[model samples]
Target chain A: MTMRSVGDGKAEFYELLPGREHVTVIEPRANPFRLDLRELWNYRDLVLLLVRRDFVAQYKQTILGPAWHIIQPLLTTLMFTIVFGKIARLPTDGLPPFLFYMAGTVIWTYFANVFTATTGTFAHNAHIFGKVYFPRLVMPLATLVSRLIAFAIQFAVFLGILAYFAVTDAAVQPNLWVLLTPVLLMMMAAIGLGGGLIVAAFTTRYRDLVVLVSFGVQLLMFATPIIYPLSSLPARWQFWASLNPIAPVVEAFRYAYLGQGTLSVGMLLLSALVVVLILSAGVVLFNTAERTFVDTV
Target chain B: MPRPVIRIENLSKYYRLGAIGSHTLREDVNRWAARLRGRPDPMPRTGAAEPETREGGGIWALKNLDLEVGAGEILGIIGPNGAGKSTLLKVLSRITAPTEGRVTMRGRVGSLLEVGTGFHPELTGRENIYLNGAILGMKTREVDRKLEAIVAFAETSQVLDTPVKRYSSGMTLRLAFAVAAHLEPEILIFDEVLAVGDRAFQDKCLDKIQDLARSGRTVLFVTHNMGPALDLCSRGIVLAAGQCAYDGTMNDAVRHYQGCAVGGRRQTR
Candidate 1:
């Protein structure tokens, strides 16, 4: 069958059977492939409302409120500077340890928060999923967008720090490569969302996997360049480390903003390739899971 | 003549039962391993044969039922508890899939299984109006255009901007049914949702359903209330023991329904 919108006074199209028999050349519309994008578009205000709700609910009624946005990363940067920069004497390529870790923390926070929030999507919203039938993907996408607000708040703080250091002759300067920040942000979001979707799909069948995902995501922070730069790892371990996907994102951020680390163009391209594969697999699995998840969840 | 809006053929669904925790893992693995050895696996232990479909039974809720709902037809399905009315509507709404058969449906399917399916409690009523409308397959502009009417219909104009969490259950139900009424989907499925609202609101909901019927939409209703069933449906089906016991005029179905409730039951076909 063919269906069309009634946007104009002209006839909308809907063909079935004999008159359309020769239309086998066209692709068959499947379960949600025939999804009405117009319907989702119409719900844009709802999407905005969800995004706003997520942003506020995270910090609302808290003692510290949204100030935790800056404080969390500041504390994280201090801890990293103590452990990796002091105890391990990790090289930051002569950049101050605080400056080095803060960049990575702000960028890493975006990915980590998005991943953790999205991974529990089905389990967290079991009540909503069972009742409603909007585009299921909208939940995760709205979460990712909401998290960008937190990232933006932290980034402004990072810029303030950068400005303070530059004026005080603390050896900070905005580099030309900083223009690559948006690309790095996109890569981080893609990997986080793609990985989170895979976890969400698996968690619906095996509930234990949800706990593992939370634990694994935390463990992954140390595996990535969160606490230290990629330079600290040995040459043999570097190749394997770059394969972690988030490693390239962190490395790229450090290279662009801090100007004290190496960013391998080839490795970043490889990370993009891996993200594309992961996201494609995620979409297929998420689509298949949504069919029976209502029953299983 | 309009084509059939919703069609189902020989639809069946099955579910497996097992222990809930890690202790069952060993048995599940043993079952698989025994199957690979080309031998009959162990069967359920004594009393493990409880049917899964009947709220806690292990039998089919619906067995090989064929149904076709024409465009603009208001079909009311009446059945005893466990007669598979809700299960059938769930399948039609694409909330779940049938195990052994297929359903071919044209146009969108909107189901109001309960109030506030996708409503976020922290969001205002205005926000949920759009969110629920989108879930029901209405476009954004359609919701925007009808927003005033929806709030007005529920008499909730004053509370539109208030968080839904603060609304009473009756107020929530009123707003929810109002959104459903305004959705105007090609096929609308209602599963005892009308039973929740107050008497006055139920009348309003019933009147809206009657209006929708006149608007050339197909509606599938499951209810025990015979008056509204007969008022809204052109035809009805009475289900007993997972099969259709009677399918004919609304009055006949109601009569069969009444007889089953009062007299010692007749043998179900």
Candidate 2:
């Protein structure tokens, strides 16, 4: 029998037969927590292609195509202006309600898209996932990247509105804190991926959870400080709302540009800590689920 | 002999077919406990289709399977329906996890389990070449290098920019096979993908598969087309009820399968 190592070294050399060395061992997942970074890195091009496919799938064969991205937020902001601004008499802290709601919508849309898209990672992609082998995480990671295209489009529109308000009334003051844009986006991505993976891991078995997700996202929107200013809430409610993790994210995003909402270093730090914990936990569950999700799904 | 590229030992994959209903919180707790104790699945039964052979309320798709293949061997796996052929391929491709045992391979493996996987009918043929190529484990630069070749080979140069939905099924398969042909994995597995195209396209695919095998790559394929299967493979495996019924030359394996079909379950017993 001949025994020799291939390449620099055999990471896992199995000699099941004489003179035969096996490099990859496929067995039941023993340790799913270890990040399979090498496998994921090799398939990085697949992730990019998947993202490109998403952009094409969105626009292909549709008459409106990219127009929908622009129109979606514009229409939603218009409704919020009418409903919350006029009918409900929600205070925008002296800033124009149109600009205020658009800001919230812009940030919220990115978060919601990332959250909802990753939530269906298992069930929606079961067909392809069952047939081929790529890092299953590639699907969700692509969603995180592809949704950025829509978010960028809407972000430009938000900046346009901010420029108008900054020049016209000076009520919406643009501060150096606006530099927090990328950081705020990262925070949302973390929570979205973390929360979505947790829910996706369970939704495979329960499935009823899948039904409640969209509705739950709406409830979460209400729970956050989206429709109302944190100052408008009662003191006790405001304290609870500040701990929402996303509350400070939304607050910081608005305060960075408008310079009027409540912003706190302690609260922001606490929220960041919570988001990190949720994301770490999400990664563990998501990794575990992807191993054998096909059999169950 | 060529060095072995794949080795499997004591491989088993059990499925809970009808017991998806017992998926309540209590069952979840039971399964978790069993796993905690390093025990086999607590569920019973071993088949979804063979209701007559229900073991312990679970279905063992591939039970205690042991297989190995040397580099450059063209293995043809011929089996009856539900004989766990696809399950074996899926396990080898790492598409799903095994319930028991281990499978080891020395080289990068690619599976053509289906043509045009992740193909959006909305996307044009030119764009889909990149998407399909990536899914099949090709790099972006690799696809770029072979773009014109793929287009010309598939005879899809005229409709390269047209959405795949507009193409006839034959054109779609040709384009898909073109991408599949260009994939350069060390180990390639196929599942009935070649028999779908027309005679001309099928011959073209057979030639490509032959070329792949000739170039020191191990190719394992599952097919029901006996004539082509026998012609393409010298060594064949006949699977019956998730077990290897016969392993030998393609001629003998087909004869064994045909004989078993006429003899029924009594022969295996």
Candidate 3:
């Protein structure tokens, strides 16, 4: 029998060998803790392609197309201004109600989008996951990046509003803390992604969590001060309210954009600590779930 | 001696029967209590069983299977439905985990467990090409390099930009197969999806698979059809009741499967 070598450095032969053993043994990993960074790095192009697929496929047949991205937030802000500002006569901390609610709506919208998309990672992509093998983390990670792209488009609308208010009226002022805008956005994303991954992990077997997610997010909005200012909370409840991870992010965003709301370095640091804890826990749970979610999902 | 590119040693996958959340918390607590006392499981009948016969509470999709695929070999895997064929492919592709045992694979694996796995009907044929290619682990540059050949092979260049939902099912299958075959990973797995296409396309796929094996790529093919198994593979394995019943030359394995199908004694090699 003649022996030939393959490109992967293994030898091939015409005759079957009786005693040869397999070089790679695949067993259930005792601990699915090791993240395959190299494999993920190799599949980075796929992540980019998936992001493009999501962004493009979302607006493919719609008449409004990408306009819906702007329209959704614009309409929501208008609704909030009428209900919370005009009807309820809520305080906007000396900032115009439209811009305040707009700022809060834009940031909250981004977090909500990322949370829902990432949380549905396994359920939505089960078909793809069942067929192929790549870094499973790519899907959730791609959702984060693509939603960030969507947020960028919406952020452009916010910038247009900011510029309009800056030149025409003195009601809204851009402070130096505007430099912290990117940091605040990153924290929102981390918290949403971290929370979404935990939920996605649980949803494989207990599908009740899937139904609870949308309902829970709506309830969470009431808890976060999106329609109202954090300063309006009674003095006793202020400390406990800041404990909500999203509370500090919305507060910081409003403070940066309008120079009106509270922006404390201490609270921001505390929010960052909460994000780190949730994100690490999310990563661990998500990694373990990805290995076997295909079967259960 | 040449080393085996794929090795499966005593691999097994156990699955719970029926719905995933069928048990109540009370039943779970009782089961745990029974186990704590070093006694037999309270509901042994509902416990895990081998996937082939489905006798117990749960089923073992695969049970203590030992297999090895040599480098550049085309190994045909054949069995009846629920014979652990799909389960084995899922385990090999790492889509699911094995409950017991281990499998080691030396190179990158490309699996076509189902055709058009990530294809979105709303996307155009051209766009689905890129998306599906990426899902199959091809980089943008790689897909770009193979774009012309893939489009040409599928014969869908005229309607390339049209949404795939408008295309006939055959067109979709052709495009999916063309992309999958052209990616050229080190190991390729196909799971009975070839039957979707016409006879001519099926023959074309078989020809491509033969060409792939000839070009020094390992292939694990699961199929009910024996013609391709005998024609393309040098070796084959027949799985029955979640275990390998026969493993030898392609012709012998096919004969063994035929015998079993006709209620004859299962001949082992």
Q: For residues A1-297, what per-residue lDDT tens digits would candidate 3 score against the true structure?
A: 001123333245223334442233356864555666766897898888888888888988789988888999999999999999999999999888999999999999989988998899998988888888777889988999998988999999999999998888787888888898888889999998999999988887667778889999999999998999999999889889999989988998888888889787898899999999998888889888887887776
Fraction of true contacts kept, per model? Answer: 0.24, 0.70, 0.65
TM-score of every candidate relative to the true structure: 0.86, 0.90, 0.90
By TM-score, the best candidate is 2
Best-to-worst DockQ order: 2, 3, 1
Top-down lDDT ranking? 2, 3, 1
Q: What would the per-residue lDDT of candidate 3 be over residues B147-247, giving only the tens digit for each residue? A: 99999989899989999999999999999999999989768998988878888888888888889888888888898866654578878899987899999
lDDT of 2 by residue, B1-269 (tens): 57778888888888777756335555667778998999965764234445456555576889899988888899999988999999999999888888888887776688889988888898899889999998888889999999988988899999998999999998999999899888877799999887777888788788888888899889999989886656878589998778888999889888999888878877777
Considering the two chains of model 1, state its CAPRI-style docking category: acceptable
Best candidate, lDDT = 2
- Tens digits of per-residue lDDT for model 2 on A220-285? 999988888888898998899999999999998999988879888789899889999998888889
- TM-score of chain A, all candidates: 0.86, 0.92, 0.90
Ranking of all predicted structures according to TM-score, beginning with the best and ending with the worst? 2, 3, 1
